[model samples]
Target chain A: MLNYFLFLVISFVMFAIGAYGLLSKRNMIRMLLSAEVMFNSALLTLLVLAATADPIRGGVVALIAIGVSATEIGVMISVGILFFKVRGEIDVYKLSKSREQKSRRLKT
Target chain B: MIDIIVFAILGTLAIAFSLLVVEHRSLVYGAISLGFLGIVNAALFALIGFTFIALFHLAVYVGAGVVFILFSVTMFREIPTVEIRVKRIALVIVTLIAISLAAIFWPYSNISVVAQSISYRELSKVFTEDYWFPFLVTTIALVTTLIEGITLARREAR
Candidate 1:
């Protein structure tokens, strides 16, 4: 009985905000948080899409997605820690610039 | 009628909290907002009859994910200073793309609005019998990731 369009709109708006944060935020942890939001948006859409046919299936799938996302957070947090240990900073801009320089050096 | 009302309120709150998650200056504040968003989404799941998913979402996402994020935020306590970047064009482009995708998908939403009743037993049977391979793979993957994370973090400790 819920309006599926309404739910989709909410998910899409959340996704846009997350994408904006991912792009604009320089902090690595915040970027990860934004990524979580984007992941939630995808899960929301999937759940809503499957709600009408077989919610149990959606539930199982959502469970899998949730587990995968948790693993993702764990691995990424470890990487963030490693990055901070090596660089003493967690700014995405600086990290990306360094990566670009590394790539250019390899090409040379 | 009640379902629609509940869904509306939950969806609105989820969206609002998600915005706060993205826009908050403090990392802890953003993580808390993200937790709230997860809670609202779990409620939204329940409202639509996915009770088991809602419960698991609440337990895994709101319970574990938020705590993990908070722990990560605390590990690097140095607050990042705001850097002004000329990213207005990027924002506009992302917004336009999202809006177009929404418009294109709107018609399909109306077609599948009906909620069919399904039980947890049915889901488990199907998951174990048909998609058991994926389920087993996920378990293995999770365990491996945990081991890798522990190893990675411990190396820093040493």
Candidate 2:
């Protein structure tokens, strides 16, 4: 019980930190990484629960989740590559504001 | 007992490396650390005996995904660009506080901890046997994602 509780606490703390990283990081790669952090933390939570369960299914589900996430990571990495190809930098601030300015100007 | 110790150590390593991935300036190092983190997670899945998921996790993540990240990171080689970095001190402090608060509250609210329920067997069976529609959907999703991945990578080759 104590171990399980500790797992949850750690996982949630990781998730929150990841969330902040995702939200606040100006670099696109960092944002992608923050998302990964949030994901692994959740995966840990699932495994802990599965471990404690009467009939353990946690590992199986986690496996599938990891597969899906890996695919997502592939996409994110590609997106980063393409962005770097065009922009020369992976800063979200420069990317978003430039796009936003274009749209705002076009609208006006 | 063995599982608990392994989980604790692996979990700590995972958390620390993930933080490094988030903080590392070089995209190459971030991607490399991310791959290691993914590998650790896949191992954790294996220890728990989900062979199918672990295999795919290794195949798709550590195999193809990491390669792709490294490929993209290398594209920066020809471009003389200094990476635009993250520098939000206030955001970091706020995030630290939020994480601390969440860590305090999360353990108490977990359903399994509250119910002392061991539903792992049930969920596994439910996933494999009678309730398999979701798995089928996941299969289709994986196929489509693969197709999309290939398409996304293919530049107009004349």
Candidate 3:
């Protein structure tokens, strides 16, 4: 009982903090960090599940998840570069996507 | 006894660094914080006995991946220095709601449905047999990723 509860604490706390980071951070690089936290949180939980199950397949699946995370990091970094190139900064506030909102208000 | 203690420490570090990465306004620092978190996470995985996964996580996440983020971060000439003020009431209300939901779904304590009903050995046999092909596919996928990553770097340079 205690063991399961421990796993529970690890999973929930890690995931929630990650989610909070994702939601609250205004910088793109911070967003990326939050995203990785979210990914790690999921990985930890999945590993605990695999441990509890003690199945060989669980380990394999865990490997799959690891591979997925690796690929995701690869893609995310490239996207981050492109974002830097176009916007020249990571501040969420400075993104030109909101330029239309500002211009509309100005016109009105 | 020691395992639990270690797990607790690593978990705390992971959560703290995660928060740091999220809250830090400097992009470079955020990226560095993520790198630290990744290394800790890899250690946690190994401690849990997921050796292969942990090894790969370290190599791919900490070694190769976060470095990529740091490099991408450097591509920017100007760091965003503007601060956006968040409304207090909205922040408090949302935080309260999130806390309430989390309380209800509290893992271990109330996630009683996570019945420890299955055996790990059975699942391992099944995976090794049926999932071999999928494993190969992932290897291929990584190779493709390397190709794509190099091409993207080149294209962006141009």
Candidate 4:
């Protein structure tokens, strides 16, 4: 019981850290890294719960989730590369600011 | 007893590296930290007696995913440090969410923590027999992503 609680706490902390990063970070790559952290936390939680209930099913789901997450990271990094190539900057704030300015100019 | 001690050490390292991944100023260092976190996570899975999942995670996440991020990070010679505009707000939101989650999950704290040793044969049987459809979908997604990645690489080469 104590061990499970400790693992849950760790998973919770990781999830919080990931959330903070996702919310506060502006760099696209950093944001993706943060998202990865969150994904990992969720996976850990799933495995912990599954261990108590059904290990086989948990392992299978985790395997598929890992595969899906790998694909997600690959696609996201590719998009990040393309974004950098086009704008030469990967800052989310700057991207949004540029879009706002464009809209304002169009309104004029 | 030994497993708990090992898990505690790995969990602490996982949290520390995860923080580094988020807070590191240099994108390359941040990516490296993410890789380390992945390694710690794989170790945690292994500690739980899921060796196959541990190896798969190490291979896919640490090997391929982190490498891809590192490769992309190298392309940017000068990455400006991202300024945090709403640290207090973000902190408040995260705390609220964490508290709510804890409350929801408090009932399950009494569950036993037994390390179940799962073999590859049983895992494959369950994967193929029960969850084959999801597996098929995942395979399709993987193939599509591979094709898309190849196209993107070729375009960049041109």
Candidate with best lDDT: 4
lDDT of 2 at B110: 49
State in Å the error of residue B1, model 4: 2.7
Give the per-residue lDDT digits (tens) of candidate 4, residues A21-60.
Answer: 9999998889999999999999888888888888999999
- Fraction of native Cα contacts kept in each candidate? 0.65, 0.31, 0.41, 0.67
TM-score of each: 0.91, 0.72, 0.75, 0.93
Of 1 and 4, the candidate ahead on TM-score is: 4
lDDT by residue (tens digit), candidate 1, B38-107: 8898887776667788888889888987888787788786766575484696599669968997988877
Cα lDDT tens digits for candidate 2, B112-152: 33223335566567678854675676677677767766775
Q: Candidates ranked by DockQ, best first?
A: 4, 1, 3, 2
Return the interface RMSD of the candidates, in order shown, one decimal each: 2.1, 4.9, 4.3, 1.9
DockQ values, each candidate:
0.63, 0.38, 0.39, 0.66
Model 4 misplaced stretches (Cα beyond 4 Å): A103-108, B156-158
How far off is residue A22 in model 1, in Å?
Answer: 1.3
Steric clash count of candidate 2 = 6
lDDT of 1 at B36: 90
lDDT of 3 by residue, A50-97 (tens): 666653566677677777667777776766676666655566666756
Better of 1 and 2 by DockQ: 1
Q: Return model 3's CA RMSD, one decimal.
A: 4.9
Residue B143 in model 1: lDDT: 91
How high is the lDDT of residue B87 in model 3? Answer: 33
Docking class of 2: acceptable
lDDT of 3 at A104: 90
Q: Could you tell me which 10 consecutive residues in candidate 2 chain B have the lowest summed lDDT? A: B78-87
